[model samples]
Target chain A: MASSSQIDLSGTTYCVLTGASQGIGRAIAAQVSKMLGPNSVMLLLARNKEQLSQTASLCESKNVKVFYESIDLSKASLLEMNFALNKSLEGRRVTDFSTSLIFHNVGSLGNLAVDTARMQDVPELREYYDLNVFNVIALNTQFLKLFEEVEDRVVIVNITSLCAIKPMSGMAYYCSGKAAREMYFKVLAEEKKHIRVLNYSPGPVETSMIDYVLAETVNKNLRDVFNSFKNQGTLLKPEMTARKCVKVLLNSKFSPGEHVDYFDDE
Target chain B: MASSSQIDLSGTTYCVLTGASQGIGRAIAAQVSKMLGPNSVMLLLARNKEQLSQTASLCESKNVKVFYESIDLSKASLLEMNFALNKSLEGRRVTDFSTSLIFHNVGSLGNLAVDTARMQDVPELREYYDLNVFNVIALNTQFLKLFEEVEDRVVIVNITSLCAIKPMSGMAYYCSGKAAREMYFKVLAEEKKHIRVLNYSPGPVETSMIDYVLAETVNKNLRDVFNSFKNQGTLLKPEMTARKCVKVLLNSKFSPGEHVDYFDDE
Candidate 1:
């Protein structure tokens, strides 16, 4: 384990990132590799192995070991699968390879329609909870274990949404799931003082999930409202958001128990 | 079906309430019975059959036909169980009933110290999510069908905690769970305009759950802090809290888009 005083990137650093195949997850993995250097071990977990391999290729081609696992995190069986994955990796003799950081960026906003009637449908409700809440909890439960004997700073960044703070039209289930994850991280931060847990609301970024929702049922007027925000050119880029997040994780000035919003920073 | 001018209490008014055996849930049932009279119906769901029987007996005497189901709502299978329960109840006279309200007031806080190392334990995490989130989502999904045909006011009140807004020690999991519920309600409120969804944070109250949490914890400083709040007479009675909640539910002026905290009123 590396000491906090002598923070050396040459020492083996392990980072487990979810949703790493595309969007913000892939960008985050890229940024972490550049910042932490070649000796750091990056475990990319997502549903798409092809994209994961592409991401792995982008990192520095030195001692950087990138491992990708393709699995559906929404399933209840993810807990067992994660345990097995950890067991398999236990034999690797990587000195100073401490799991110090965890990034929870896996989430999806399935369709956007303000239909109270359809909201109750079993399939819709199940998908909402599974993607938004269950996956986050399952992954976090698994990731938190790897930091048992942490010698340096341990950071867990939960990529929540600005929508989680308030409510939005046609996104009740999505909001509910995100809010659940936000609260979970908050409590986890307070309970586990040794590790820094950040419930980060990245505001509204142009992501595939948002695009799908907007295309589906965004009211003309509502679209105009969102367009105005986007036109202002304030929406965060995935890589830029990733950098800010990593900065926060690495910075010792920011306190452990806090909910940091990107909009709040502005 | 009652006309738009008349208050419609004729619909099945399918309500799913947790912790119905005692405290706020029982009070909510009593108030709903008084408000709706013989026209209203309640599905009393809780763990204690004897206590649920008492609640049912009391509610039936008020001319509010009450049906009790003894089941642990925290179980993972609750969503399926609730769906079946709703289906079985569908056979009873299909009146012009619309699902009017959903009150999620069931949760217990295990006042354990925050151990960062053990935070990843799967069993503990599962228990936390089950008690706080699963039941809330399950009940909302199951009863949402009852509100489909009518344009009546459908309300969901998720009982939350003050700790959710601010940080607290030892009660991290409890606070996180409540926060998750709060966010869920917020999203529900925004997405479903016809249905009045409220993420209500009720400050510390004299409940069996609170008593249990306090009894187990050995932190004198924390106990002193809680004692100060109690000594200050800020802690509300269960009945008073219930009555206030009823007022919020019945008040047409209370909008659906805001997070309501009881302490804010004080």
Candidate 2:
């Protein structure tokens, strides 16, 4: 493990995030806006324009600039998206923004709307991978490529899930997606020395994803856990989780590339 | 770990395998055809109809029934495939096939056609996941659901790779997809009690994929391994790998839903 580098805020910094419309993503967006410099730029992309617009409004800062895209990373072509991103990033030069940060908070646990939810080769499971894994890789690459030429550091804070390390009964697709993501970062860490990658699994947080599990899931154990989290308020707050995740990513003391869980005190 | 169930193929059996046109898949198809009882059905599916037809021709055992489908699993709807498969299996009842098995050998490491390959979000990577991870899940589910009504057993032999467990400098997508797949099986082991899943890492074999890696990969370490394997004839033959994978999958002594690497003597 190498010494982690600090992200300089005084210089204009760019923060790119996915699933930035709601839940942990929204909370992280608001926190990032406040933590980054006054003139820092944040590009928030998600499926819902309404929620994203609402989130953009919530991240209101005196000097920080925020941009939102309602595009779907899974469906959109990487070439087209990269072209548009290159145009948007052309406005801000590499020297101007000393560092660029990325937070891939987007994740899917598959469709739990049906009580008959069980693992079988299904189209929905593939969609789940697209939402949770493919989009994450594709979008991450878009940003990494965007900052590839820059001499300054580019850090990717992958908001991984605990299920990545542990096998979940019903959410195989989601668990698998996270596992893929974690491994991807591990390779990125190994190959690209200049860039930093962090696999941060933020246990369970009070988010809309959890609400979905509680409302629609047929898996008794997961349902029980979510119900308990809701009833007992055992789930961590998204704001706090966002703060801790960002802190772990930007701070200089932590290792450059490693799997760090929120529950782990270290 | 729970006790594993042996797939009894002395009675009527059905074996469905992907990437059956060549390499380990073709070998597995031939091996399975010979192992199963007379009149047992074996469906070989892959992209190339010509190669698949040739492979199917070779699997012509005296009593074994060989079938081939050139349908693209990555693009086709699993639900539709399941519906069609259900119809196909309707002619013969569950008792007709004492044990139904699936060997998912279809995988893609992506085009190592260039030395310039490096990590960045590309459409090819997403396509690779679609081919490797998504289709495997979807197709596996279709068969698992197909055997749900029967008292007979269902076993899925997922032909995994070493890349799933280790991170490679130039092959992030392949590693990530395999990781996702291995995790999926782990969850399947946890959830599905009746259906058996084996994460069988085939290790390095003398396949076309290896040829591409050796010729085009810029990664010096991987190139060296491929070179050594190619020159020294150290790579395990597809026939040997297929035999080991099938042996582990069928025998009841092994633990249920275990990730077994080829190098592991177990």
DockQ of 1: 0.37
- Candidate 2 per-residue C-alpha lDDT over B128-171 given as tens digits, one digit per residue, 9 for 90 to 100: 77788777777776776667766246777888777777777777
**Per-residue lDDT over A1-266 for candidate 1, one digit per residue giving the tens place of the 0 to 100 score:** 22223223444667777888887888878888876654567777778889888877775457677777777776647555566447535665333564467788888875565453344443455556666665576666666554555524566778888666676665656666676667667656655656666777766666676567557754454466566767797666887777776666555344554667765553
> How many Å off is the CA of B77 in candidate 2?
5.3
Candidate 1 stretches with Cα past 4 Å from truth are A1-12, A61-63, A75-99, A110-117, A120-143, A214-235, A250-252, B1-16, B31-43, B57-99, B108-132, B215-235, B250-252
What is residue B40's positional error in candidate 2, in angstroms? 3.1
Q: List the residue pairs that clash in candidate 1.
A: A176-B184, B11-B96, B11-B97, B12-B97
- Residue A164 in candidate 2, Cα distance off native in Å: 2.4
Best lDDT among the predictions, by candidate number: 2
lDDT of 2 by residue, A23-96 (tens): 88998898878777667778888889999999999776876777888778667677756765665565777556
Candidate 1: C-alpha RMSD to true structure equals: 5.1
Interface RMSD of 2: 3.1
